[model samples]
Target: MLVEVGASARLFGGLEQLRQRIEVEATAMGVECIAWAPTGTAALALVRAGVPDGFASPLPCILDKLPLETITAVASHQGTLQRLGCRTLGDVRKLPRGGLSRRFDKELLTRLDQAYGLRPEVYEWVQLPETFSARLEFQFRVEHAPALMFGARRLLLQMSSWLAARHMGVTSFTLRWWHDVMRAKTAGTGGELTVGTAEPTQSVDHLSRLLNEHLAKVELQAPAGDIELIAARTIPIQQESKSLLPDTIRQGEATWLVLERVQARIGKAEVVRPLLAEDHRPEWMQRWPGAEEPRPRSAPDPCQLPVPDWIFEEPLRLAERDHRPIYQGPLVMLLGPDRVEGGWWHRVGEGADAQQTNVQRDYWVAQSQHAGRLWIYQQRLANDETGWFLHGRYA
Candidate 1:
C-alpha cells in the first residue's frame, strides 16, 4: 500500500493560503491529505507512519491512551506475532480489551483498527512547494566590508535550515555588487567573484568562512556598491564514511581563508610568490616578487644548480684598481659577462640622452675567498666612467 502526506509551508503569504495550496498539490498527486493542529501529536503520528491494525478511520485520540498490548495479542493469535521493537500491535492484541480500557484508554485500539484497514481513514494532505526565495534592497549603496558581511550572513542562515530540512547542501551562490548610475544609462562599475566549494557543505559557519575569505581579498573600485546574495545550487547528503582525522585537517581551509583576508587588507601587489629568473647575471637571475598569476607547477630541473637564498636588491660599488675593480675572491665559477644590447632605435633620435639612459650592460658573477659566496655584477668600460656594480650575493 502507498501512503503520502503533503504539508503547506508559506514563503510570504499567510498559513491558510499555504494549506489550501498544499491540498491542491496533494489532489494532483492522487493522495488525500489533511492539516492537523501544529501541536496535535495523534494526528502527526498517524500522518507520519499511517494508521495501524484495529484502529478507527481518521483516528482521533491521544497516543498515550491506546490499547497497544491487546492489539499485539490478536496478531499473535493469528500466528503473525512479530516483535517490532516494543511498539508492535501484537503486544496490544494480547492484553485483555476490558483491562486495557480500565488501565489507560481506547485510543490505541481505535488507531490500530484504522491502521489495518478495519475502518476507512481519510486525510487531506497539503504539500509545500519545493523552493523558497527572497530579496532585499538597500536604501543606500553599501561599499563597506561590514555591511556586505552582515547582509550575506542573514541570507545564509535562512537558506541553511531550509536546505537542511530537504537533506541538501547548496553548491553555489551569486553576490551582485552594484551601484546607481552616475551618468545617463550606464551604471557605476562593479565586479563579482564566482566561488565554488571543494565539497558540498550546508553549515552556515562553513559557508560564511569560505565566502569571507574570498571577499576579504576583493577590492571594490567604488566605495558604495550594493551587495546581493543568492543561492544557486543544492544537493542531498547520503551516508558516507566519517573522516579519520576530521579536526586536524579541517583547520587548513580556515587557515587559507585567514590568509586571504590578510591579503585583502594589504594591497594585493604586496603579497607575492617569488620566482627565480634563469640568467646567472645578478639582476637578470634574481627572483621577482608577485608574479602575475599562478604558473603551472613543475618539478625543478635536476640539471640546474640550486641558488643561494639572498640576492642583493641593489648592486654594491666595488673599490676600483687600474680602471678594473680589484677582485679578491676564490674563483669558483664565472657565471656571466653576458652582453645586453637594446634601445638603439630610441637612441637614434634622442642621441646622447638615450645613450645615457639606455646604455648596454654586461653582467658577471665573482666568488669571494673570505666567505664562499657568489657576488653579481656588470662590466663598465672606463672611458664612459663605466665600473662594475655588485648586484647580488649567492651563498
Candidate 2:
C-alpha cells in the first residue's frame, strides 16, 4: 500500500500530520509494519529492507541503504554487478543506461527509473462499496454466541476500515449465524439478530460492546458454523473542526450509544419517549413510545388554567359535603372551573350502546387542608348525579 501523499499533504495539513494519520489508522486496523519514502519504489524497497521513515534521506543514500535482495528484478545480476565493482544502487546507476538495458534485463532499468522518479508511478485506488456484508467461517462450530466474539472482532475491524474509507457511519447492522445442519437440533437452518443505534457511529469499541450485550442474551438452537455481519443502514459523516472543549454533539452521541446498548441487552420496547395524544381526558392526554426527539406540546390557554404536575391513572373519588367535595378537610377552590366535554363518538363503536362513554367535567385547581395542592374535577352526569374526584397534585 504505497500511497503518494505529496499532493495530499496540504489537505491533511502537512506531510508529518498525514503520516501520523496513516499510522493511527494502520494501528487501528492491526497493521504491524509501515514505511514511507519520497517515491513509490523507494517506499516499497525501504519496507522490504525493514527500514522506516526514509523519506527525508537522499535518493542515493536511500537506494544504497537497501540490500541487493530487496530489488527482485536485479537480484539475479547481483554477482555480475559485484564483478563490475558495483556494490549498491548508486554504483549501478553510474553505468550507461543504453548498455545496462542491453546487457541486463529491461526490468533493472525500469526499477532504476521508477526509484529515481525519472518515470511516473501509477496506482489503482481502492473504493468502498455501497453496502457492507462480510462473512467468516470457523474451523470448529461455535456452540454459543459468546464464542463468536473472536470472529466478530475480526469482522468489526474490517468494518471499521470500510467505514473509514467511505467516510461514513452506520446506525444499524445485522449479525446472522448459520447453524450446523448435520448436527442441528433446531428447525431452522440459521438465525439472525439486528442491532440499532440511536445515533450513527464508526467506533469499533462502541459497536463491539453493543454486539456483546446482544449476543449474551441469544439462545443458540444449534452450533453456529459461520457468522456474517451486514451494515444495512449508513449515513454520511461530515468532518467537524476540532475544538479544545468537549463537543456537545459527541457527548450526546456517547449518551445515546449507552442508551442503545442497554436497549439491545434488554428489549427495544423497554426504552420509550413520551408522546402527547389528541384526547382531552387528563389520563389519555399523553402516551409513551415516540420519536427520539420529544415534540413539545402547545401550552394550554391562560383562560383554561394550567394542569397539575402529577396526574393519577384513575381519578380518586371524593366524599360529598354540602354539594361540594371534601378531601382531607374542606377543599378550597383557588381557580375557576375549566370545562372539558368530549368522548361522544366512543359510544358509536360496533356492539356499543350510548352508556357513560361521554365526558363533561368541571376541572379546578384546589387546595386541600392536608393533601396540599390538588387537581379536582366534578363529573357532570345525564342522570343529574354529579360526583367530585381528585385528579392530580401539584408541588
Candidate 3:
C-alpha cells in the first residue's frame, strides 16, 4: 500500500513517527517488509529489495545505482536491455530518450520516469464505506462468549485504524455471532450485544475491557463459528491542539469510565448512583438511579444543615417517653426543628397497593449518651395524631 503522507504527516506527529507506527502495526500483522522513500515507485522498489529506508541518499543517486531488475517492467526486458549494454538504471538514463521511447514499450519508459520522480503516479486509495461491519470466522468453534475476544480484538484494532482515518470516534458498537451448523436446533442461530461508552472514544483497551465485562456474564447456548462487529454510532472528533508550553500535570480517567466498566461487570440495575431531588423531605430529597441512566446535569442539591452519615431505607418508629423521642435512653434535643413539610404529590403505587406518602415532619438533631448522634423527626399524622421516628444516625 502506497500512502501519500505529505498532507497528513503533521497529524500523525511527523513523517518518522507515522512511518514507525505503520511499520510496527504491519509487522505484528505478519508483514515482513516495509519501506519509505521520496517516491511511490521508489518505495515499492525498496520494499521489493528488502530495503527498509532509502531516503538517506538523494533520489537520483539512489535510483542511479539500483539494478534494472528493481522495477518489474524493467526486469522483464532485462535480457534485451543487457544485450544493448544497459545494466543499471543510470546506464539506461544515459541513452537518448527519443530512441528509448521509440525502441521500448511504453510501460518501460513510464516506470523509469515514475521511479525517478519525473512523472506523476496515480493510486486507488482506500475507500471507507458509509458503515463499518467486520466479521471473523473461527477455525475451532468457540463455546463461550468470552473466548471470542481474541478474534474480536483483531477486528477492534482494524476499527481503530478506520476511525483514525476518518477522524471519528465511536459512542457505541455491536458484536454479534453465528452458531455452528452442528449445534442443536433449540440453541437458535446466534446472539448479539451492544457495548456503549459514556464518551466518544477510540481507545482499544477501554473498549475491549467493556466488551469483555459484558461477555463474561453471557451464557452461550451454541458454539459460535463466526463473529461480527458493527460500529453502531460514530461522531467526528476534533484534533487535539499542541500546547506551546510543556505539560506537567497528568490527568486520570473520567469517573464515568470506571462506573461504566463496573456496570458492565455487575448488572446495570445493580450499580446505582445517588441523584439529589428538589424535595426537602429526607427520603423524598433524593433517588438512586443506575449509572447508565440519565439525570440532572448539576451539582448535588444544597442543604444548610449537615447531612447524616447514614440514612435508613425506612424510618424507624421510636418509643416516646415524656413527649420526647427515645432510643436506648431518653433523647436530648440539641438542635431546634428543621421543618420539612411539603410532599403531598409524592404518592407511589396503584389501587390496593397505594400508600400515603405525604409527610409533615419536624426534624431535629438529637443526642443520646449511649448513641453518638441521631436524626429524629416528629410526624404530624392525620386526625392531629403525633408520632416520633428515627430517620438517620451519625457514628
Candidate 4:
C-alpha cells in the first residue's frame, strides 16, 4: 500500500518528529504495519527487492539497477526479505517482470510502487464502541489509593446507571487511568476483577453484591490520580417466562445451578456425557458425559440372521475338544452367519491395499444362556479354516 503525504517531511517538524508521532499513535492503537516517508509528488511505486533507498534520486538509471528488497526493507522488514535469491535491488531490476510475477508475490511489486510514491495509500485508526466510558482530565494528578478508589466508585455508579437503562449486567470490564507526575503522590496502575453471576439480575444492588465480592481482592500497583471506568463487557438478563413452572422443575433449576457451579469451579471438561462415535473403530465409539437421548435398537425381523446379546471386548481363547471347534461359553444373543470372501486380488505386504486386505468374514448373532446380549463371529478362510471372535454387542 502506498501512503501519499501531501506536504514535505519538513512540514511535520521533520522526519524524526513525524516518525515519533506515528510510533505513539500506533502503540496506543496497536498498529504494527510497515510505513515509509519519501520525498516526491505523485510518487511512482515499483517493487524491486534489491533496489537502493536512492532509487528515486537524481540517478534515473538506478531504477533499472535497484532491487525490490531495498524498497521493501526500508518499508517493512519482513523475515522473507532475506530469503530471496536475488542479491540486491539491481539484481531484481535485471529479472523479467513476467518471470518475477511467477516467482515472487504481488506484495513486492506493491511495496516498490509505494516506495516511489506512485500508488495511493491510506490508514484509518480503529474506532471503539459507544459505551460507559468516563475519562478524567487532570491538571494536577491526585495519587492516593483512597482518592482513586473514590473516583472509581463514581465511575462505577455511572456504569451502573447505563446498565440499568439497558436492563443488563456487566460480567467483565477493565478500567484505565492516565497518570500525571505533578498531581498524584504515588504512581500506581489500576487492577482488574472478575465479577460473578447475579441470579436473574437487573438490579444495581445485585451487581454491587458481585462487585463487592471481588473488590476485597483487588489491589493497586501505584497511587491512582485520574480514573476512567469503562463497561468492558456485559450479559443480558434472561427473559421472564409467560408460563409458571411447577416445584419439581424449579428444583431442577437448582440442580442445574449446582452443576454449573461445579463446572465453573472444576472446569467444563470435567463434566461430560457419553456420545456414540461414527467411526467403525471400536475404541473410538462412546463419549463420557454422554448424549441426552438414549440410542435406539431393534431386532432383525424374520430371525434369518442370528444376533448376539454380548460380544467380547476382545476375542477369548477356547479349549478345542476335537478336530471340529467346540464352542463353550456363557453366550448372549447370537447374530449372523453372513459370509464375506475376497482378498485374493490384494497385493501381499501392501497393508492397506484392498486386494491384499481382502478376506472372508462370517458374521453371527449369538446369545449366551447366562451372559447378556452379544454379537460374535468367526473369521472363516476361503478354504474353510475358522477362528472364533467377538465383534459387537447390543446394550
Which model scores highest in lDDT? 3
TM per candidate? 0.43, 0.79, 0.81, 0.33
In angstroms, the error of model 4 at 299 is 20
Q: lDDT, candidate 4, residue 366?
A: 61
Worst 10 residues of 2 by lDDT: 347-356
Tens-place lDDT digits, model 2, residues 29-64: 556788887778877877887888775767767787
Q: Is candidate 3 or candidate 4 better by lDDT?
A: 3
Backbone clash count for every predicted candidate, in the order shown: 41, 0, 0, 79
Sorting all predicted structures by lDDT, with the top scorer first, yields: 3, 2, 1, 4
By TM-score, rank the candidates, best first: 3, 2, 1, 4
| Each prediction's RMSD to truth | 14.9, 4.4, 3.9, 25.8
Best by TM-score: 3
**lDDT per residue (tens digit) for residues 236-317 in model 4:** 7665554565443443334433543554445556766556544232333344751223444642232345434444566664
The TM-score obtained by model 4 is 0.33
Which stretches in model 2 have alpha-carbon errors above 4 Å? Answer: 11-13, 72-96, 103-105, 134-144, 147-161, 164-167, 176-191, 219-228, 238-255, 290-303, 346-357
lDDT for position 378 in model 1: 51
TM-score of 3: 0.81
TM-score for candidate 2, please give it. Answer: 0.79
Q: lDDT of model 2 at residue 346?
A: 57
